[model samples]
Target: MTQINITRVLKGKYTIMIVLIIGIILYNIMNDENLTFTENIIGRMIYTYSLFRNVVSLTNYEEIEKFRSNDCSIYKNLIFGFSNKNELGIIVEHSIGYGENQEWSILDEYESLEIENIMGNRHWIEIDESGELTDGISMDMNRELHKDEVVVNFIVSKKLLENNNKLKQNLIRPVKCSTKKLCSNLYFDESKVKVVYENDNISTINKDDKAESPGIVIYVHGGGFVFGDMNTYEKVLQKHAIQLGKLNKPSIIVYIGYRKSPKWKYPIPLEDVIASISWIHSNAERLGLNPNKLVVLGDSAGGSLATSSIASCLSIKDQSKRRNNNVLSKRFHNYCKWVDHVKFLGLIYPALCQKCVTNSKLKNYKFGFLTLSSLLWFEKQYQSKYIESYFDWRSQPLLAPANILRKFPKTSIVLMKSDILYDEGRLMYETLLKLKVNAKLRIFSGFHGIYGSSWSSGGSNALEFINSEISEIMNQNN
Candidate 1:
């Protein structure tokens, strides 16, 4: 060849060399980066295709779909069948299993075959028929290849599942504390005091000791009125308990753990909380607590409970009953003594909108996303002849805070910008203001339970900010 022709050929060879080098670098980068399952699979397929470019057949979407749907079992046979000309078999174990003694036979898989992922360390070949993967065994999205369909076994904490009878001991529960500054040496009487009484069933207490008091903050946790206990909110209580202790204006917090749904629906839990407050007011002296200082706080469904409890306390009927019934009078006198009873309410993303009138937030959890079984369970709990007639397709106005705004204490509410229950808090606060009930609102940048110190969404400072705000309000009221 002429010298000029030779130079041109050499230039082409050099260009090819550069391309190969660049391709190898890109492959290494993709493998090193953490990727989603789909992305990882796509990347691997691309890499594999590059190795056997000429042997692989390129097809359109329709053809690919046809192959995928047509006798997947027959395709299964093709997967084990010999590789196309120039194609080599890579021993990849499928999440699904092949027979133990049965190795997939594809024309020696062309060149090489080796297992990558297998079922339970068991030997099985992944049959890559066409381009799609078909493992004899089903695999979890996490790539947890199982021998059979059975998943690996695990257990919930026994300490967590137990009745949590000993509140003092079960301090490690989810809602036990909001901060280390909150939880320390917490305990409550394992005794029940009458709150709701066809006869008697409930307990409550309050206290404000200037020393070592986690100033009395009454909390109502949300579990859709079905499942939840004082233990449910142990963490937040513990954190505040410690904070209050540090402040010297310590608090004797009280919680009215009420009967859950199905057995007792609607006003039952509300009555229980109100009655517990009454009992606390009456028994404050015995418990060494201050009946004078109290704040009501609730979250999720419990927000509805908290709002209703305050409404009940403010009711003209409840006040009259206390006046007539000396027993009732004495029990709640300290709590009711105030021209400003129950200084403040801190509603944390309450589920106040029970009507479910197609709010935008519902789109995220439009169906049973929040709790499939729990929602069904709640329906079952309240499904009775009397309740059926009383409750309509829409939730009762009594269940919503907007309806009870006529008489409410000065309230501060914290809401999540992205929470489904955001409007509940907003509407309630707006309603309270409209009704001349003093209210403050804070919209935080996070999801629900932003104030909590656990597997929470975000905004870690929410708990501290609210606590400080509540303390300031209580001091002002005092």
Candidate 2:
């Protein structure tokens, strides 16, 4: 090689070394403010280097093909990794979001779990009046939907959905396949979700059509996006439900479910959350719930979905922006129309950014049960192969534009001072304030999560605070 070429190569090598060295400094240097008093020093240190096995279940290539659409077991044991996997700490490459880059798999009992399709959101085929594929998106405008116990399974249209859009399809390429036939056969396919309903009684039995509309609190559970379910979270779910039931007005508690990852990623799980809106709205009466009076409550990863499940659907009225894929875009537009009725949003320590390495992450990485190491793993499993997926505003709501932030419903955020996500939670609050959204924030002195496990004094305090906040918001809306 020439002398000048050798000089350039040396410069590149030095630059890479400098970047790697800086990343290690950030990873190992702990921030003092995020530390807590004496407790589990070794256990926490162990957790810092280890992750729940299910979080990385989909990272294996062969496993991805075995269980195409099943979520991993919530009980998977923990796995340890000595090397740092922080976005800046260690870099892995050669990525693609779709087609020959499939990185997903399943849980052992995923077959039964797939029954979350209580909405019949599968195999929805739409043909035109002439017995051919419908030209555009069309739902049965005059169809009647039925409710089963606490679940309702409804089929949506396919014609308007097959076409690809830049933002959504980029993360969900397989949503629509190459064959024209495959395009027509695509369904939202949320069959793998685990739905939770507080009541099984059908309102239509003897209900008055003109009776007052009941407010709906749709709760989404958080399991680091790997291991939470309505079943496992029954305690907190009941807590939120029972507290909300005491309101002066009639209310319904709907715990919505979505596909989980490393089995499902990005737009897929989000689509299930969005579909809950459509399904509930369409069958609100039978379910005795009012879609117009929705109040979303989500914790942790659920908080992220609860935020985007509404924000991403916010009025895309400017048709020109997403006109090419009008089906999903139209769903987005329509979701916004009714979304204006959303009364409030309750988020607890929501994971907001994909790439941001905040001070809290650096400080609380060891103490927080959900360490930065585990969080980065969960994020990796949740993201698409596309590099842009990391920066997508839907997943990283903290990075969203001002107008988007302004459109959020009255929101309440809960942050734990010694948690890895504390800084980002505060950032989300500050951003909302800058945009003038009616947002509220609460800071607790606990670690990352308390609700998912045994409810402690901290959990009780947090729930009480949230309950009071909900009561106030409900009173205002009333």
Candidate 3:
């Protein structure tokens, strides 16, 4: 080879070596045990910028426009990554703004006005009738009003959801249950069923199909408050329901489809939970549900919501006693009565406290890649003032006052030893116990998503513990 070609090759090899060394150094710094919060934030920023740069480099503007198209299902697939193995047929119903008919807009007048000015001199100035803000920007008007309005009645088969390794790897994926004889899609409303006996005659009815008053379990799934949907957790919930049924304790599991953050922030998810519980309470008699036997179960971010919702209910009840009446607070005070029916709460590897992230026990606890930067990113999307008011108990239930903690119902918390939030869960459980609240803590050995992943044996154990507690509560109520 010529000397000139050899020199060029040598320079290229040295350049590659330098890049690799820099990458290794950055990785080590990011994972450093003694890294401060500021350092962590900087590391996360660099990591995010690198990822964005790579993505932009790979896709051209034309391809980006195509991906942005409203008709393109790429965004849906990207967000909801579950697979439909077989032709699993299911029906979904969509409604707008609770019971009222309301035309929803994606961008408000402010955003629309801004975008209109951007396309002032452009030749392609078209505003679609179906809430398309721009050519490629669109929004689901129905979802904008409220997510609970969108309901699904479908049966998930065990065979259809039989452990797909590929699907499990993806954090976000669609899960569909097969429409075979094993399961049937069923819908139940207040009109379909009615309470067989009055509240005074609770024990008089037989434990048969007609007389049995099934307990209701409202499940809230977890996905860091941003990702996840009913489709992702349908199988897991169905399995829990079937298992509960086998114990001769029939129960209806209602999977809550709460709105995610960035679009709907803070108290919005909690509001949805309150609304769902209110609807369930109003229709408890017709749904053959024991109004006194409601249980709220949540995992991860859902756990935070569950704790916050319970706390909010207690706060409303206490505030109602005072004479200082505001219209909004009064409405909340009335709504809080419905949540009073909740008898038990179950949390699985829950994110109870944000402050605990930097606690002595958890400062270096690295499991998932959700570092301080990711938390800040989510906060930006959520449009929260948490950065300024970091110790808000609504976001961190562990920081709640003793009175609120004392009012918690019979609680069961399941924590994984390998989880970053393990210490936070332990702290919460301890606080609950200290307040003389009926609480149980179960610790297993695995990472954060183990319950949702292949290591779900721990989840079964957690379920058993929860069921046993529920049974005890039921007997006491009886």
Candidate 4:
């Protein structure tokens, strides 16, 4: 053979050997069903390298989707990253057999008017001349309706609500401080009060009695619809209350404990939030709360709830205007009385749309501490068989009708650039602006739950942004 031909053959053999080696490495990485620690580490490194290349090349949408759908676990872990061990620990802790092997129950009854009252103006009943409950709807009617529609719409089976009367329980149960003591504590300093409305205990924090009535902030805590309560968020709430008090703004901070999902289904949590708003409106005078200057603030899942609650209020208002019946109109009007009072909405890295979970754009994106798989898992646990039910604005606020979006209050959206929901938050802000709703967007470089760690170096900016928004709202009213 000629010398040149021999060289060509050698080069071809070398190229084939390299390709085979690469193929074997990829096959091992992809085919390992139950990877050892060492194998997992190697797999992660390879996945990360591939992800980096794809991102740098600006991979097309189809290719990204194919990659994500092909290997969900590896894709998720790679995007979630291993740098934040603390975050990884949280994910593992929360994901251990998350939704499986749990007790389930079917809600017994359905009551449209009862549900409506809970969703609308259930707080409006008053003591008549005979000192008896005097609302137009009868208990019998509520019972009959409960057997029908409420069961269909609001019922779900889950471990959290099965044994415990969690629906009526106070969210601050874990605080170790009674209402009176909490009010007197150093953090609260006579600025906190606990009140029960509709069998649900809510915490109200404000300034000293002599201070002027201030704007109201109805705060909803986030736990992915399964874990958070007032006690979990008390310190942050206290800090905001204290800061506002010192400024002489004296805002009434209402922490609502709504029933969570996988325990209570779709409309239940939303209705509970609405009930709290109704309670605030009914007692606005006594609480020294300025109803016209109300701000609804929520983080993560709570942001979704906050947005939906406002949408519900707006819906109730529209319905009330179209109805002529004095009784129904009165109930809806009472429910909607607080709608106009909502002057601002603060969403901190909110899960605005579940559909965003499967969006192709986020397939290669690093979702900070939250992984796409975990988000999907939570969504399944929260909605369960009612996945189709999320099409409405009640579950996904971004899916709200244009008419409703137009009526949304001035919104201040805080998005952590690293969060999976960041794009959705920006989309929501832009959509609000397109609908002519007053809106502002602030993006920070942080993780999903950074807002809760306000004292941490990474979260301080988010905390300050929130404080400034509150200050701006107070100034507007002043």
Best by lDDT: 4
Superposed model 1: Cα runs more than 4 Å off: 1-215, 317-340, 365-388, 391-404, 455-459
**In candidate 3, what residue range of length 10 has the lowest lDDT sum?**
103-112
Cα shift from native, residue 123, model 2 (Å): 17
Candidate 2 lDDT at 453 equals 27
lDDT of 4 by residue, 19-42 (tens): 335535664555433333333333
Candidate 4 stretches with Cα past 4 Å from truth are: 1-210, 325-328, 357-361, 364-369, 384-390, 452-458
Candidate 2 overall lDDT versus native: 0.51
Q: What is candidate 3's lDDT per residue for 173-279, written digit by digit as tens? A: 22222212111211122112211111121222232333356566777777666656655565455556555544445454666666655344554555556655555
Q: Hey, what RMSD does candidate 2 come out at?
A: 17.8
Per-residue lDDT tens digits of candidate 1, residues 1-478?
6455643532344433443454355545554233333223333333332232211231222332232243222212211222121111011110111112222111011112132321122122233667443433333411432121200000111221121123222121112122222122111122212211011121223321232212346777675665454334444554554454334253434555654443344544554555445444444443434556777788777777777666644443344455587344432342234324577788887766554443535533211113223334344443333334343211232343343466677788887654556776787777777878788888755444334533222333567666786667556536
Off by over 4 Å in 2: 1-212, 318-329, 333-335, 389-391, 452-455
| Candidate 1: Cα lDDT at 117 | 21
**lDDT, model 3, position 378:** 44
TM-score for each model:
0.50, 0.60, 0.60, 0.57
lDDT on C-alpha atoms for all candidate structures: 0.43, 0.51, 0.50, 0.52
